[model samples]
Target: MESGDLLLYKRAMFRLAHISDVHLGPLPAVTYRELASKRVVGYVNWQRHRRHFLHDGVIDAIVGDLKGACPDHLAVTGDLVNLALDGEIELARQWLETLGDPRDVSVVPGNHDAYVPGAFDKICRAWGPWMAGDGQADPVGRYTFPYMRVRGRVALIGISTARATAPFMANGFFGNGQARRLAALLDDAAGKGLCRVVMIHHPPVKGAVAQHKRLVGIGRFQQVVARHGAELVLHGHSHLPSLYWIGTAQKPVPVVGVAAAGQGMGGRNPPAQYNLFGIEGEAGQWRVHLERFGLVGAAVLPARIAELELAPHSAQVSLSPH
Candidate 1:
């Protein structure tokens, strides 16, 4: 090939690493005074169940493997703490520093991070830096939903579906307020010839999670995609590996969910894992290589999972029911 052809043939690639549901462990000592609200029940639940499934060793192994690959950016989809206690939030901040700088790591909270009625405020205050909206004024130190972070030609959009539910529910909500803003954001990103990637805590597909833990107003979320369109969507909180398609104006948007980053053996949850996406090509023709890394035996390693091809814009599309 000639020099000019060689230059044109070179692929411009960007790597993004996605992990969620870390549930950073060894909970801080909690006194009875702090458990007055719904946290009392959550504290008991953590002591009984969460300690067994979420292992710090598993997180260490996964992080080690991810760092070896050296992704351009890391997207953490929350559940950083078990009960959203003050001490837990503070510890999570310190732990996030280990992953990378605040600018290099983007985060969105989960239901567990906002486990109680008023704990959301504490979470916002503690994790504000990691969740800031792109080029938006956040004088109040609270992050607004649908935050956009542009890396190369890919646009990483973070949306929060986290909310404090009742004693037995782990539900998430994406209200009308967020939905309106999301449509505009996605449209703008697409107009600029950028690949739009929507990241949220809960899966947006119908029946993705159980009734008690489902994302309320998922139809609104779908409608926005149907109108504006996005290339990909990443989420956590199902604690399982999943790939589903949502309809958009051009092509179906691939929505992916990952297992817990700290899950170990002997549990209903899948083992600890994270996803790496290799994205190349321009807005009209994009190629994504999705790879999953997990503990095959006692060692964590990488494995190729799926190869996705998205068609150019101007293609006819329909509304996907699920």
Candidate 2:
């Protein structure tokens, strides 16, 4: 083994902080010009001057707990913004900057990041400073996903589920290039005896938005994953956590989803929650201890788990399909 490998192994208790769907900054009241339509925006307009669900307090608590947990690495699944607004991107940037390092943090863009026309190709570049430089591009921005960073043999594979879809579609998609590249990435990483963790903006399993089932063409992606196998898979578009086993001929990868750290409607679920995974063992022989950290009244409560085991975003734009 390498030098620092022992430290990670000896500790065998490093924290993996997972958070998604920030949806920062509310929408400003606009003039309809007709003078008839009033009362802010839509009937369920979540982005108003006032806080609807996700608020600053929620983020503050989450950030504090994240620091206290002392995670070795951080992964953000996506939906960093609410309406794909320009300001929202910067807002998300500030929130994420609180983390220790950019190299240790990995992210994938959700549907909202690309909701407006050419949002990904346009706005995401500006998010560079926050992430320490254009956030690791993939050849002419063809696929903006970042490669896995190895921390004591732990590999993080990030995928882009950000696509510009049709109106009334709150769905996500992954193209051909991304799928093929992802398959190869998994194979290579697995061969290296590295713990492979796949991160995306949408859930590869199902649920979240029903009816139209905008999960169009995830079958191939699933097939590739099953072919090579993964240790863990993570996402955050649904604003809820659903666990599943996506196994290949080689091994099984536990896929999980989490809610928005800033979203909590009348204390709907866990007010602005985030997940922490404590893993132990080697590449293919790893184990997970999943627990949650969230806001409790005014004090950030910690739902800590000691050497445990087990497993376990947003809206906008009518893209892909609803």
Candidate 3:
């Protein structure tokens, strides 16, 4: 059944907590061999700048506050580690444990998590359970990108745009391969009467980021959504609170970008904030109540943003598929 044909319940509700770009700090020591590739540039930048902005205490306070709210599920949009070092991945694993159990958390990788060639594979191995699909587990319990996990009436789809890039570039790509699979996945989930949420690290809209840090194949990603459609899109690469609309088969999908969860207040960078979304309403008329929580003084508290109605409006014009 197509999503348009499904009958959705009016009061069915789900609460989700979204935090991204943690960039978990104080990168571990790297050997000369590790810095041979792109690590050298990242290392230099971290030492000179990132170390101060991405604070451990800030993230701890933010997580502590999130736990107090206790949403139904947690979605981390990536950049958990700065360098993707062996130790960094392990450290992120321990941090994930602190956030929540694998069963309650869904994660997707970011450009920083796959900063080097072999680091992508390393992330898959270490963060497998967090990104696993809804299907039966493999004998080895391995994971693949664009994985889907169905939680109650919602289907959380995880897509990876995190691939190693040359120095000075913080870009991501959703190639034709992932695009095709994503379209099918969205359709399947929608047909099952699920509220589809696409989780990716990079924004799928053109000009969303600098040329060197943008999602390279955003056109392909947009095309897939235009054909299949989704209820909500959650991403984290820009490190700013943002809301954009993308054209889909039945409506304009709302793509939300969150600020870096661990960032401190002293710079041009946005302060640490996480998004809370209350999803409710029935088929064809879903509503997402959005609340942004940020660091103020020593406390992480609610910064009520806006409540959004996500379904396509009757008189709303369709967005171009650029």
| TM-score (all chains, Cα) for each model | 0.89, 0.80, 0.89
Residue 317 local lDDT, model 3: 26
TM-score for candidate 1, residues paired by index: 0.89
Q: In angstroms, how far off is 124's CA in candidate 1?
A: 1.5
Listed per candidate, the RMSD to the true structure in angstroms reads 4.6, 7.0, 6.0
Please, what are the lDDT tens digits per residue for candidate 3 over residues 1-322?
5564432322246889999999998888889998888899999999998998888988987888888877889999999999999999999999998877898999999999999988888888788878888773662122356888888888899999998899999989888778877988999998888889999999887777888889988888887888888888999999877778787545788888888998887756677888888888666677787677776554455344444444445223221111
Task: Write the residue-wise lDDT of candidate 1 on 1-322 in tens digits.
Answer: 9987755544356888999999988888988888877888888888888898897888988898898888888999989999898888998989888999888899999999989877778887788878886776773132378788888898888888888898889988998888888888898898889988898998998878899989998888988888888888899999887777787534777888887898886777768888888788788677776777776544455344434343433222221111
Q: Check candidate 3 and list the clashing pairs.
A: 8-283
Clashes of each: 0, 10, 1
Off by over 4 Å in 3: 1-12, 139-143, 248-250, 297-322
- Compute the lDDT for candidate 3: 0.82
lDDT ranking of the models: 3, 1, 2
